[model samples]
Target: MDYQLIWVLLIAFAVFAYVTLDGFDLGIGILFPFEKKQENRGKMMNAIAPIWDGNETWLVLGGGGLYATFPEAYSLLMTAFYIPVIVMLLALVFRGVAFEFRFKSRDHTNHWDFAFAAGSIIAAAMQGAMLGAFIEGINIKDGHFIGGAFDWISPFSIFCASAVVVGYALLGAGWLIMKVDGPLQGKLRAIAKPAVIWMAANLAVVSLMTTYLNPAYGDRWFSTPNIYYLAPIPIVTVGLMFWLWHAVKRREKTVFGITLSVFFLSYLGFGITLFPHIVPPVISFRDAASPDNSLSFMLVGAVIFLPVILGYTAYAYYVFRGKIDDAGYH
Candidate 1:
């Protein structure tokens, strides 16, 4: 149980890292429709061009870690979310292709831009849907997935998809607030105002939906003793949202930090809401986790290489600091 808990925590941390790091880049792509100028678009791409590839490492880490540590959980999740997962991978491929092709063609730049932005939207939406479906729970029988193909498709998942899109947009807007300035930055600040508002609204809706739609989660949250541990999450989230609103309005550089804080807080709330059980309710992570020897072996490689990954990510960002104004590569 101890090792299982550790492995799950490791995988969860990887997930948060991927969502926080790659999320903004995807958000930048989501912002494509608003910008008409080619140069501005170029700069947008340039801003993320250096570390974009590295940002994807966290996805691999998270997915790979889950598969390694909790094979059963990973297997059931994959079987249930087969289509959405495949679609997300395809969209990510398009985003990568657009990154290269958009730079190569002058006449077809807008065409590639559309592809890039659309890919971001598709990837982000699918991820959100997957998350919502995960929270809603998968159909399990005899410790295996018994649900049909469309089980993940639902209205709640659709709303979650929208929430994820808005969330990524807010993250991207906040990121831009740090990296660029002038008219473009001003516009981002303005855009961020509504993005913040919508994000808060989405958070509210999703929180309500979780408690209403999933009685297990609702009972877990609303019941006594548990609420004492859980109350701080919502309280802190409200405070951060208010602070984020103030930062955006004041045109403070702290928007980026606050945005990251919001993401962290949201992730924290999610973890607290669903813990001990990787699949929720009946199936504990301990039941799904791999044997101790296998987990230990996997954890060894994970711990050894994590620092290297973080170091590389940090160095890449450091080398590419400052506002991007051109299409030049680092």
Candidate 2:
């Protein structure tokens, strides 16, 4: 009956899907500079080639779902973070182009490679900064964003952006560890070792900073009654961090799964920080949702289409489930 809450969870699911799916491809781009060998780079590209485009389907779903289900929040978010949104979109476009063209040209491969890496970095950074800006809260008055254009740029946003880059790279390294073997996999193990360390450090800093910046968040976690329920999240997170380190060192395939759990926990903490609030600190899901009639209508479509999308996505991964070699996926 709570259409508003349902829609919020749907949107959240879509965003998380996008992060987990598209993350590794963007991460591959982030890790490109570290590996200068074209043969290995080709292998890396080959690893994600089939699924990269499909991974972005969740992004479209999330963005469109927000507009349909939470028009007010979408409007305000677009207006408030227009610059970063545009930059992120453009970067994704450029990255896609690089992905397609890099394989086509022999002589200009390096240029396309650089574009892909740069685009991935820029897109990931903008996404992280936008998240930071959203978390820090937006300036709204009488339901309208009243902040200046550059309000999204700040030390916290920059720090968050840097953290996301490292996080994505970590995801990418774990992915490579799973998809490739031999020296490439070994190199990714090295990359993932340091990447996980930095990611863990960043996660700790960001968690502390988030609480320090918002006293309500501090109370939500550390306050007596709430603390009891929330304590297990951080404890499990620490355990997973150790597991991830061990997995990397042992070249275990579970490395990616462990890394994903860490991201999922971070995402869960973020949701906890802003529960019910789509625009955060100002507007809530109930405040932003469409009319009941509209929600009901869309819900019908979502129900019908959601399974199809999931089915196809699962099939694609299943079909390409084989590992990548110098020759490509097999």
Tens digit per residue, CA lDDT, model 2, 1-330: 877888889999999999988998899999999999999999999989999999999999999999999999999999999999999999999999999999999899999999999999999999999988988999999999999999999999999999999999999998888898898889889888888889898899889889987788898899999999999998999999989988998865799889899999999999998887899796989999999989989999999999999999999999988899977788
Residue 141 lDDT in candidate 1: 88
Residues 25-81 of candidate 1: C-alpha lDDT, one tens digit per residue = 999999888888888888788888888888999999999888888988899889999
What global local distance difference test value does model 2 have?
0.92
Q: How close is candidate 1 to the true structure, as a TM-score?
A: 0.96
What's each prediction's TM-score? 0.96, 0.99
Worst 10 residues of 2 by lDDT: 250-259
Q: Roughly what TM-score does model 2 have, to 2 decimal places? A: 0.99
lDDT of each: 0.87, 0.92
